[model samples]
Target: MDDGKLARMRQWMLTEIAVETACVREQIGKAQLDPQVMDVMGEVPRHVFVPAAFQAEAYLNQPVPIGCGKTISQPFIVALMTDLLDIHSTDSVLEIGTGLGYQTAVLSRLARQVYSVERLAGLAREARQRLDSLGYANIQTRVGDGYLGWPEHAPFDRIMVTAAPPQLPPALLDQLRNGGRMVLPVGPHDHQALMLVRKDAQGQSSTRVVLPVRFSALEEGEAADLF
Candidate 1:
C-alpha cells in the first residue's frame, strides 16, 4: 500500500473523469452534484480497497470483483448515488453492503457516523480491517442480513443500499428517520434502476428512478461469524 502511488492513481482517475475520457461525465451529465462528494472521491484510495488482482483497474471507472460474487460499483455510480443523498456533515448513514469499504470510506468523510452491513463474513472482516487501517474511524460494520437493517442503530439520517433487491426492504425504510434519504438500485438481474428515496418531514416516503444500474442482488442469511 504505497500512499504516493494511490494518490497518483486517484488524481489520474479524476482527471480521466473530468476530461470525459471514462464517460463519467456522460453517464452523469448535469446531474445534481455536491463538490464534497467529488472531494471524497478524490481523497479515497480506491486501489487499496480493491482486490490486489484488480488494483490496476481500480481507477478505471468500472466495477471489479472483490469476492463473494460481489463487485464494487463503478466510480461514477458511486459518486452519483452519494451525491443524490445530499449528505450533511451531521447526518448518520446506514449502508447496506459494505463490499470493499470504499463507499464506506467516502460516506465516513461526509457523515457523522456510518453503519455498514455485509452478508459475507469474510468481506465484512476484510473491509473492517481495511477501513480501520486507512484511518476511517467513523464506520461500524457487521456481517448479517442487510434486509433486516441494523435495528440497534435505527433511525439513521440516511441509508444507502449497494446491492439491488427485487423490491424495497421495509425494514430499511423503517430505519430511516423522517426527512432521511436513501439511494439504491432496484429491479431484476437483467436491468435495474437506481432509485432515490426520500422520507418527507411528514413521515411519508417517495421514490423515483435516477438511472439504469446493474448490481449484485442483495442476499439473506446469517453469516458464519464476524471473523
Candidate 2:
C-alpha cells in the first residue's frame, strides 16, 4: 500500500486505540494515553515490522503474526504499556521481547537508549536489521533468554515485556532501577492481565493490573530458532 493509504489507516488505528482506552479508563485509571506515546505510536510504521503477507493488517489496532507463534502486540496494549512506563528522553529502557522490534521502535523514539532481548535468534536478527534500516541507531539487540533481564545492562530506568510470564520474573525486578517502572502481561497463556509494576527509591515494588490481555508465553532458558 502507498504511504498515504498507510497513514490514513494508522489514523484509524489511533482512533480505535483512543476509543478502547476510554472503554477501560476505570481499570487503567486514565481516559486517554500519554500524548507523547500516541505521537510515537503514530510515527512508527508498523507495516514495516510485520511479515510481508500481513502488512495489510498492520494498522488494524490488532496484533499481526510475525511467525514463530508470536504476534506483535495489539496497538492499544503497546501504547498503554509504553504510557505506563512513562519513559523519558534521558532514560534507558530494556525490552524483554523484541518481536520484529515494533515495541522496541516505539520505545526507541521516547528513550535515550533501548536494550532489547529476544529468545529466538532469527527474530532478533530480523528485528535488528529492520531497526537499523529505519535509522534507529540507539537500540542494541541480542538473542538471549528474556527472563535473564540483560544483566550486563542492569538497573534500567524502565522495562517492557511483550510476552506473558506466569509471574513477574525475579531478574527483571532486580534490573529495574529504583523509581523505575515496568509493564507486562502476567498469568497463564489462556488467562492473563496487563500489569504495571513500580519500584520505589527504596526498591520496594508495587503492582497493579491495568487491564486483561493475552500474550504468548515468555520462553525460558536457551535461545531457539524462530522457524
Candidate 3:
C-alpha cells in the first residue's frame, strides 16, 4: 500500500477500533502507561495481522482468528501488557508465541530487540516475512516449542507469552533477568488469568493477576522425558 493509502487505513483503524471511550481512556490513564504506548496502539495496522476475510473487524476491540486456530489478542489486552512491562528503548523482549506477528510488530516499535517463538512452522514463516516486509528489523522469529522458552538468549528484560500454560514453566522463570517482568496467561484453556511475574533485583519473584482471559494452551514437547 502507498503511504497515502496506509495513512487513510490507519485513520480508519483509530476511529473504528482504537478504544477512545472515556471509560477505557480512564483505565489506560490509571494503568500509568507511557503516552507513547497509546500512540503506537492507535497507529499499528491491526487489520493486516488478521486474515483478509476479517479485515473489516480488525479494529473492533475484540480478538480475531488469524489461522492455525489462534487468535490475535484484543487491542486493550496488548496495550495493558505492554504498559505493564514498562519497557525502555534498549530492552530485549522475548515473546512466547508469534501468532500472526501483530503483537510482535507492536513490540518492535516499543523495544530495542524482540525474539519471538511460534510452534507452527507456517505461522512462524509468515510472521517473519510480514515483519520483514514492514521494515521491522528488530523482531527475530523462530519455530519451536514455547514451553521450553528460548534459552540461548536468556536473561530477557521482558517476556510475553501469548498462550496460556497449565502452570508457570520453570524454564521461563530461569530465562528472566533479575528485575525483569513476564506477562502471560495462566490457567486452563477455558478459564485463565493474565498474570504478571516480576523478578526483583535479588532474584525473588512476585506474581500479580491482572485480568481474566482465555487463550490456546501451551503445547508440550513430544519427548516424554522433557518437562
Model 3 Cα shift for residue 58 (angstroms):
1.2
How far residue 164's Cα lies from its native spot in candidate 1, in Å, is 0.4
lDDT of 3 by residue, 1-227 (tens): 46676677666654543443334554334624567877887777777788889887776677998877789987767877887788889999999989889999989899999999888877787787778778888888887889888899888999999889989999999999999999999999778988989999999999988777888888877312111
Q: How does each model score on lDDT?
A: 0.86, 0.93, 0.81
Model 1 lDDT vs. the true structure? 0.86
Poorly placed runs, candidate 2 (over 4 Å): none
Of candidates 2 and 1, the better by TM-score = 2
Error of 2 at 154 (Å): 1.2
lDDT of 3: 0.81
Q: lDDT score, residue 20, model 1?
A: 45
Q: Which residue runs does candidate 3 get wrong by more than 4 Å? A: 1-32, 222-227
Model 1 ranges off by over 4 Å: 1-5, 18-32, 224-227
For TM-score, candidate 2 versus 3, the one ahead is 2
1 or 3, which is superior by lDDT? 1
Using lDDT as the yardstick, the better of models 2 and 3 is 2
In candidate 2, list every pair of residues with a backbone clash: none
